[model samples]
Target: MIQLKHVLVLVFLCVFSGISQSTNGYELWMPYSNIEDSSLTKKYRDYSKSIYFPGSTETLMIAKNELHTGLRKMLGLASIPTNSNRLENTMIIGTKENLNSDIQQSLSKAYVEIGNEGFIIKTVSIKSKTVLVVTANTDIGILYGVYRLLNLMQQHKNLHNINAVDTPKIKLRMLNHWDNLDRTVERGYAGFSLWNWQKLPEFIDQRYIDYARANASVGINAVSLTNVNANALILTPMYLEKVEALARVFRPYGIKIYLTARFSAPIEIGNLETADPLDPKVQQWWVHKADEIYKLIPDFGGFLVKANSEGQPGPQNYGRNHVDGANMLAKALLPHKGNVIWRAFVYSEHDADDRAKQAYSEFVPYDGKFMENVLVQTKNGAIDFQPREPFHPMFGAMPKTPLMMEFQITQEYLGFSTHLVFLPKLFEEVLDADTFRKEENSTVAKVIDGSLHNQKLTGMAGVANIGTDLNWTGHPFAQANWYGFGRLAWDPYLSSETIADEWLRMTFSNDESFLEPMTRMLIKSRETVVNYMNPLGLHHIFDTGHHYGPGPWVSELSRPEWNPTYYHKADSQGIGFDRTPSGSNATEQYAKPLQELWNDPQTIPEEYLLWFHHLPWDYKLKNGATLWDGIALKYQQGVDEVAGMITTWSIMKPFVSKEQHEEVTMLLEIQLKEAKWWRDACLLYFQTFSKKDVPDGVSKPLYSLEYYKSLKFPFAPGIRPQWD
Candidate 1:
């Protein structure tokens, strides 16, 4: 949010003097480069003449060290620690209790407002000296405040009269890593797993510490290290030792470690025949396991169990319900103040209901039945993470239960890491969606932050895309997805535009020329992806197995919902799933207003037209295009949008490092090529049923429908069967 004139100066300094050392994105966003604005540099230097950080705890010391590093790099000053206690031109960093009595009394109301994990970074006038203060209620908050203060400095914000006090709306902002022990990641576009299991416990990689730094910078307080497709061996003593090592590294950054508990671990590792929730031995084993984990790592977060879903073992194996399973674990962790995050991403081959409605039907009746420590984690959409989807119906339905949102930070369904899709745009849209739970404007953010439901526990979990790649995430811009996820998890209501602006300023360039167009491009990237891949509410049309390309014709999987044809019921007569009263009636799961609005195909948004109802091939769209033509045009528009991105990037090449520009240019080329692949492949396949041409505005198919159908990838990055 820097003014235009200052922005121009920053850009000029960056372009001419090479102030931005954006060589490879290995630094993530904490580059700590010299300030691009000369005026701001002097002002920051004046404030950083000396620091008064008065604490010996690890978190506090980390904040003190960060100040040294930031000041040294950005302002070219040592700003070494001094015990003189001279208030003049000093940067004070401490908890509220550690601050001077006079200042503490004046800031008591601010301290109370920020709660435990919030912090204040302000320039205060005390005893005729201009001193900047960074104070919080807890050590972790001090660390967070220091990170925030550095970030503002990184973005070249004027801190002269700054008064910023912020807190996380959600309690547990976390990254759920789907990483395995063997070094493969599920749905991971990034090269390989970050955890080197063979070298752990003894060999502590610097990457782990940097990962914690990155997460802590954005206010992510918790992490689940293992895949939800759980492995019981991870809970064993050997792996627990490894987990303990990771826990130690993350501890200083205020991140609690969570492991996925395989539902049948009692049988798999505990030498018990059954993992039945009601059984005495099974319950005892889990209690003992929790105790053992806590003994190793005192602040260990509880399990993230993905049970009774996707072939994973659960309480249903023993004819027990989810409550019985969740409560048993909850009881074990309750004494330790740990939480059991039970994923509600369940669908069954046994149930004869729509896949989208099954989670709601199964979990809604059991609302308020779960133990206090148990949190039901639900995905953003009812279905798997598609490019675009209507908000899941379960967010408002399970009112009595504490529901945490689950969003995919990886690009599993959106052309992988190759496409520069800014996912915060997608996250923002979902957060702003009104559920009409209690009344109008009851947004998904309210439900997640406990403003609407007044729930005790609230969280937002993002499936991590991190790996051993040099840039952290595979594509450089993919870093923004991880960055945006944390920012949104910290404050769900923050706009994607604001996130794009901040990320650009910190990671790439703060200049107005570079920031303005890129911000717009980043904000539009997700929709561009949506338009190309799954335009007009098409869901899960990914091909069989790898899902690397278009697969709308895919069918004949053993499970009915596993096939793309199941989602998009394209036929000679019509297309789209029938979720209205006459069909699945999934709309009935939503609130009354939504149900009313969604029942009719004509009234629903065209983007979601196919999701709620089946429509005729010739149904007239609002733009006067037929249904088939509209779909074709949207696919074409998506391709054109990516082309526009290329053009925009090409123009801004002078603003970025040559290596970065070239790397992204190559990736965007792949994205455009694939966009055409999606456009042509799907359109050609759907045209068989539509019995019409692709329409005037839409581009012609580059390849035949048969060619697209015949293509197969045997070794996509995140594939199935072996999964490794």
Candidate 2:
């Protein structure tokens, strides 16, 4: 009996060990691993000797708990509470009003600069004793400061004599989750939606709390908890209670909940005759609905509307315009200080001219017509989220209107989370592009941040990539995209390199060996995707509907703009859409210098060469290679880069955890395979037009053109669920 019991105990121990060995990546960048360096751990313990935080509110308690949790995990010492009012070397944290008089006087200058949402952390001498103080104008600010302090500790940076005052450049930074009511996430590759609507408002999952914590740490202020393809049922009483419960959970973390407002909700939910913005009954219904939502959740953010686009209902259905649809809702939300985010990603089937010019033509004419509370959210590129495209002309064109930036954090068009593509590089390129609207330094970032036009309300929205996956993002490196989006939304001027370094240190390790190579790989990952999939200003050539892989030959869609053949006007003579003055004149939408620069093929940047001006197959590129040769070489270069990334990660086994290292290694192998697949498929299709041989350095595809085109993906993940 004793021998049998020993054998069973050994088997149980083996199973337990196996479970612990698998790192699920749930902790994200806030792993809070114990500090291995004895010297740094001792220093952190010394700084966090005692806590002087004083507040009974949930937000304050959250701040206190986070500081304690992070400190204990990192330094193995919980902060002792201080009984006396006099300050020593204890860490002090609270709002400016809640802090004691002596602490307030010392931080008055810092407080004057930071606005309501900004925070300040500094070391000060109080009563001849050194104390570190984190003070802000509000409890949310205090919470932000706490996260900042903890992040610094996680990076193993010294906290002594620290003085930092930070404020968000934009007024609102939000994450738009494309999650459906049934827990299905559109374009979400991680797993099912984090929201369990079936069990919500009663059985709140711990995931919701962790979600709030992660967003709070990154300074994301708002979350739209539904798909932009809005449904009317979410507005009904059955769902409002569930949304309210989520709001209650996220409120303490400074995250306000917003919902996508279905344009026909009046007809669907209120049983009205028509959903017209001009109809008095429709207007009254919206006012009552807004009032009802506010009663349940007083701090509700607002509505995100996708109107008259992609067959969604809008004021256009009722012989009205976008301003009419947006203003009607704005008036109802005006009393609650809520704003309406009307998307500018519109294109009509009738407009057979360049689809790229449709949004600017529709919105620019009515620049100043929008209400004060309405913001026009424009995508980074005019044409869908292609791997590469020029900045949207709408950025600087709508000077009188407040245009917010909409960046897709999910890899819908790029590779759907299976391929590791760092999107911040793509975002930074768009933000840093010069618009030349007002002056030389007039960048797209300046336009969206309200500095160029001196606009009051400014905001940035990222379509979130979070889900129920053990790792918040499917790929380990994909989390950096979410982190990068928040950091850029907070400060548009920050470089991608800076963000990558910060994330690498916090998420993986501070070891220079791991940080150096991984940072290089991340910085170049997006461009590698662009090179393989759509080099030289190519746009929207993905497969129809799901957009999983390449389909440059697809042209069967009913609408002209819906087909890949419409965007890439490839023929026997040459390739690319001619958007120049001789063609569609889409360059005229940009400001003066850009219009002149893009009209001529010689003056346009090589990256945007084919986008504006279609040229002959034998045209010479800037690198002295023929256009066909350059295109082929770019495809090969992309595949080579992926191979290099795999090799780079292979040597990083010593620095990363075994589970993380193995997961990334397998993902990188998948990425390399997909990269080759993209290169072979696109080159074969375009080769028919060029009628040229593959370049010297380019590797010839193993499969025939027919073989490449015959590939199908009927069971790809993240496809939009068709509802009856």
Candidate 3:
């Protein structure tokens, strides 16, 4: 057996080796960076000289261990337990049930406000000395409380008068990993899946603990382990054991494990002749499978399904609609209180009609047809995850359907992992979009949490960007998107600017010298990427398959809908696909006021001008510039913003650690090059149809359109195999 000294050396070696490995961004928000704020360090040291956790439960144990580990790494000292006369100036942690009678009575008022999964941090004078008390209603609550206290210390906030009560607004806050069984993440750029399935159940990685800590710190309550485009093999006995191991690790952190269920699992797992949802044997198969999974993992969050979408098999294959399919699985999981999150991202290669209208048309009629445990998961937009898409038409359209908002934390459309695009602003745009259901502010948030529709069982899913990289999301700044997703998932009402400020304070430096410019850079980052990549409602312009770089000229895919040109419909007459009455009449899907507003380009927001209507090259924009000039200027503005981000990050070099500062500096350079690439490639291609000179003050394309079009990336990553 290895001695204690040997164990210490092994741990040191492992941590150092992990850090030295190439900067893939797998570390995420759990950087565990040594705390830098001098005043804050002293405050934490004074209040946490010793900790006495009264509870002796598994959750309380986890809370104590995590607090000890985090403090040692972050504050350079571990908490010592005290027994004799309550140690003054020390941190006290416990559930209400475990606290001493007198202490419990005093903390009762605070506990009432804390609620379940809520906590309170207060500095009280005990026998003429100040002691910080961290109390919660439950052990899991204390775990969250401990993390919250640490976060305050890390951010260098004054712990003198801390009183915060936070309860998640949504019932389910989750990360939906598009990670495959073989560990290849769909649309994932950082690296292979963080889950090493082959080594799991035998060897539990420390990374799993770190992942749990990162999530719990941000109040993310659940994680789906597999891709919605799932593998049936994940449900077999072999994989169940692997999943149980993960569940064991995550359980203490208040995160429940969920799996993606392949819709045709009956046929795939049970050697059944058919997977028709109504079939008795098929129903029995799912019931047994859910039972098997629950037996292995008691607190399992149910399945996330991607049925009848993009050629995935479903009950639709047997002529049954989504409601027919979802209800069947919902019934199977009802006994275990598990849910069925059926995705509404369905489209067809054969639909000559507008893609935006497909989901709304298929599901609106079946609004109240689902099971009580079923939730129809809808993406932010109707089409794929575009850089900028209007809110999906189904938001207020489904009054009876419990529609959960699905946002992508991964930057699949916004330049993958290389570009520094903060997505809170993007989320803010969609969340605040006036669905015009009944009133002016009938927002998407209201529809998602069952508030506007007056239903129950609220949920929200973010397609995860996590991978096996050191920094988590590839780019250091990209971690903000993940952080923002969880915060917004917890409270959808929080503004994008607010989330940016919090993330900047937590991830980077809290000094205003560093915060002001970095916050500005983050707030504008998403729009900068949008301007450079797909301006004026232009969508799906990236190359086919890999989806990297420009491919506006791509019109040779197997299906017309799969081609970039099919979405843009750019021609000599004008650019942009007209979804107006004269075109596909797709705007009819919106409610009265929006349908009217979007029907005319003159009334629409400038940010979404080209999305609704097709305009001539010289059409006058709201900004007093012609459409062509406006488009060119927007692209140039994007390139300039990226340049500004570079300058902003350079200013932060002194505030941030050299290791992190240098990594961001290098990534910004890559972003600048790619921003210009997007600009040149797009302008060169679009200039062909406009038959005009490059707009004044806008630099001419550095290369010929033919040269830009000739750029090929046959070896680009994230390409899904046709056979798979």
Candidate 4:
């Protein structure tokens, strides 16, 4: 029906407009794209035509700005006037204290259940007129509620009859940035750290503001800006000024900045003779340092300390235990109402009985010894962020102490940013793991949320994956892991399915065609990586140093725990680590039922067969295949799954942008290549031990095992710097 010149002009406009609005995944899950569904768009426009916000506080202002911005982008509406006529369909937002008396009274019942940072969003009738109200106890909660409303709109959810009451289960939902002073993040696959120390005090990067907004949207209240393997200079006046500048930027977004406290700061920066927890001079120095930090940033969240682990100096260096070190920092921070998150990830070459058993042994003994302001941070797995690991035994063991979970959002073990591994599935597996500490349903979620142990000061920390990359996280889908971590940290009970569904809708589209297949792919991704890289509970087999690729034969590390050979234990007889009573007795660490179940290879789940028992290659699995055949099949299955993902994505091109589709397609191809590399490299190397040919139906390796081993990646991103 259109003329030729009109068609040409339309094409020109569309092309130029698309160039201006092109997405490189920078918006993450908060992309407020204009709604294509006219019916839904009309409903949203009607609901948000006017606003009645009653506060002028910083957080309230942020919430107001966000509401205006999101609505303008999504509904194509200009800034809606605040405190406009509330006669019909007005969106009301404010803290309970600031709201009208009648509205505050109406929300009083719902307010009781939600704690300090909780919010209530409901469609209410006011004097015979319908209005949507977002009310909370504090300004920050109002901000959260506003973000929630935006999220719902982004996902194209119905605004009518909306009654949502939400609160964060964990008190301290935090991101532990392993970013160093030099802007090189440890185990960070993305580009350089978000913190630009060289230009900080004066030049405030807009990225910092956006970072705060992103974190605040997901209820992440705290951020430790430095690596746990800390540098003492961060505590000095020179860096404290920089950190203070950041804290000011994040404060309005309800994000409190934390610093990783170098345990030997008293000696390293203060020139003290000894960094002993018992020494008065060292204690005084820390107290003074705490005072100095609090003076600059009044609401500082406190310290995250990695002590006596991986060669980091600690109170252990001065004949003191974890309690001694943690209590000292806790005491120093107590005056400022700050908390200490002391890490429980410890292992020493000297205590080589079982590396997995060391953390529980070290911290469990000092259960009630830690100060009230201290929380012991433990990794999700006994080992370090393996693709698949049984929930750490320490979860149930430390009843008297608040054991905060430390999940790695960064894929340090599962192929970094390149691989599309959805970590929420892994996080869900650990959270839902039955600790059996009390009765049935005593989950790790319960342990960390303080319901199981009846302890206070609960928290969960995720090692941040963010960098200065244009997309924030290097890969587009890797942003899901960061989003998932924040969601889980808020409520550990949230299923991965729900998270994937939400993320896909917000980050991409609400179209069912895109959502269904993409959600399935994301949910299955972690298992795919596990199957290919560490089938049947085999773990820590990645190449030495960078851990970028397969290295099941590595045994050259000085520490036994650091060697891949120490974990797999592959030989002519079989492959696996025997951790039962007959071996290292690591099974004894778990609760009764798990101990009994894991002690026997026959009863243990086949996925963890290699972790708990050293089985023969010819051992029959539940699938009626030999262990060797099962391993090979799993590897092939993983590769096939990746292939399937590529196929799935190819068809999704119409649902997403050309750039997005192309980027993911490229990444999926890389995943397939790496999947094959893993399948071939590990199987080939293990074949030498089993002296077996490639199993039936499994693809043959293109190269020899020696050739796979000869490949090198000296400049792999995220390789731990030498100082660590």
Q: Using lDDT as the measure, which candidate wins?
A: 1
Q: Looking at candidate 1, what is the lDDT of residue 649?
A: 96
TM-score of each: 0.97, 0.96, 0.93, 0.97
> Which portions of model 2 show Cα errors greater than 4 Å?
1-22, 78-83, 98-103, 721-724
- Better model by TM-score, 2 or 4? 4
Candidate 4 accuracy as TM-score: 0.97
Backbone collision tally, model 1 = 0
Compose the digit string of candidate 3's lDDT tens values, residues 526-563. 88998888898888899888888878889998878789
Please write out the lDDT profile of model 2 over residues 613-717, one tens digit for every residue.
788888898889888888888989999999999999999877776778899999989888888888888889988888888988888888888987788888787
Q: What tens-digit string does per-residue lDDT give for candidate 1 at 1-724?
A: 7899998986766545644565788899998877657788888887877778888999888888887887787876655656557464378888887788888988888988999999999888878778999999999999999999999988889888788989999999989999988888888888889998899999999999999999999999999998999999999999999999999999999999999999999998999999999999999999999999999999998999999998899999999999999999999998899999999999999887899999999999999999988899999999998899899988978888999999999888988888899999999999999999899999999999989989979999999999888898999999999999999999999999999999988887788999999999999999999999998998899987777989999898888998899999999998999999999999999999998898987788878999987889999999998999999999999999999999999998777777888999999999999999999999999999999987887888777888998997877897744321
The collision pairs in model 3 are 24-470, 25-469, 25-471, 25-472, 26-469, 26-470, 26-471, 26-472, 27-470, 27-472
**Range of the 10 consecutive residues with the lowest summed lDDT in candidate 4:** 13-22
**After aligning candidate 2 to the native by TM-score, how far in Å is the CA of 710 from where it should be?**
1.4
Candidates 1 and 2 compared: the better one by TM-score is 1
lDDT of 4 at 172: 93
Residue 256 Cα positional deviation in candidate 2, in Å, after optimal superposition: 0.8
Error of 2 at 704 (Å): 1.4
